[model samples]
Target: MEVFVARSHPVDTHVGNRLRQRRALLGMSQTDLGNAVGLTFQQVQKYERGFNRISSSRLFEFSKVLDVPVEHFFDGMGATAVAAKRKPGRPRAPEKPADSDLNTKRETLELVRAYYKIRSKSLREKTRDLIIALARD
Candidate 1:
């Protein structure tokens, strides 16, 4: 007996493009990637052309062979588009912190301003003591 399977919305074309792009970025030829992923250059060509469907097990194997996260294949797509492309639960990078949260040379500027404002050594010493105390974690 034999079993049959079918893909509802085939996305191998897009996956193939991504794979080829990443492979080229990694400086790998189709034959080189085939060697790494345990396929012949012809098979790699088929995959790149969307003439073949990649399985989950084979995808994991490819991830191991290519030294990349499985999620690397799918990034920056719509909810439906990505779901159609691959499995559920793709990893997401964190949101960037606000500009106000990142400080650069702010302390140096504050110190220079305070130093220029103070004329007496005793006042500077008091300000330094207060700054050190405030800085204590």
Candidate 2:
């Protein structure tokens, strides 16, 4: 079956390219990644080709499965490191957060699973409010 082409952002293209590059860097074949993700090789091909949309759940799964940070897939876009560092209205030098404390795929995947278990919408909202409040201070 032929995959359909839809309108895409430059960032989408960048993300797909990054996925393919990282797979190649790890010496993983499309079939291999497909097996890891319980997909057919053709499906993996479609994703890498940017003909299919990868859902956020799949993206999170991929990050853990690949043992990379979620941002690693979008690490170097048109935005430079310095650009990513600067948020509006923040005059101080951007403090870089350390990379993942959990190194292995197992650890990363476990953390992701736990994160999805939070049950309270109010808790999520409060957490978000607190984070934004803290960041602004």
Candidate 3:
């Protein structure tokens, strides 16, 4: 008998992070995402944690539910990770940016959600301008 173990790939982890990021940005709970995807919240959690790999069909469904393109999940992944999957040799370390943590912050997500909730386009633009000016200062 042969035993096999499933390991989480870096790409999978990156996809999961993107999933969580998109979900959070939409202010959707795991239960909300699960209901839309026809899965339990626990299953959603598993996917977000990279404990289970998501199928292409499942990812497509998620894209529809999350109102994002399927490419969204792979947005920030490095070329090395993609090549690593195809080559299937020793895992290469992911190249992470120093400011990567900024994008994953709860405060950043909350700010983005709040910013998008402004109904008026002019107001949104003005808010964006204000933020940019403040950031530059």
Best by TM-score: 3
For model 1, residues 1-137, the per-residue Cα lDDT tens digits are: 54444332335655555565556555578899888777899998877656687787877876777677878655433355445544235433332221222221345445565575799999899888887999895
Best by lDDT: 3
Per-model TM-score on C-alpha atoms: 0.48, 0.51, 0.81
Greater-lDDT candidate between 2 and 3: 3
lDDT of each: 0.61, 0.62, 0.83
lDDT of model 1 at position 55: 82
Q: How many clashes in each structure?
A: 0, 0, 0
Runs in model 2 lying further than 4 Å from the true structure: 1-5, 79-137
lDDT tens per residue, model 3, 1-137:
64554556767777888898889999999999999989999999989877788999999999999999999999968776676553344445644632375766778999999998999999999999999999998
lDDT of 1 at 71: 80
Candidate 3 global CA lDDT score: 0.83
Candidate 1: segments with Cα more than 4 A from true spot: 1-10, 79-137
| Residue 38, model 1, lDDT | 76
> With candidate 1 superimposed using the best TM-score fit, by how many Å does residue 13's alpha carbon deviate from the native?
2.0
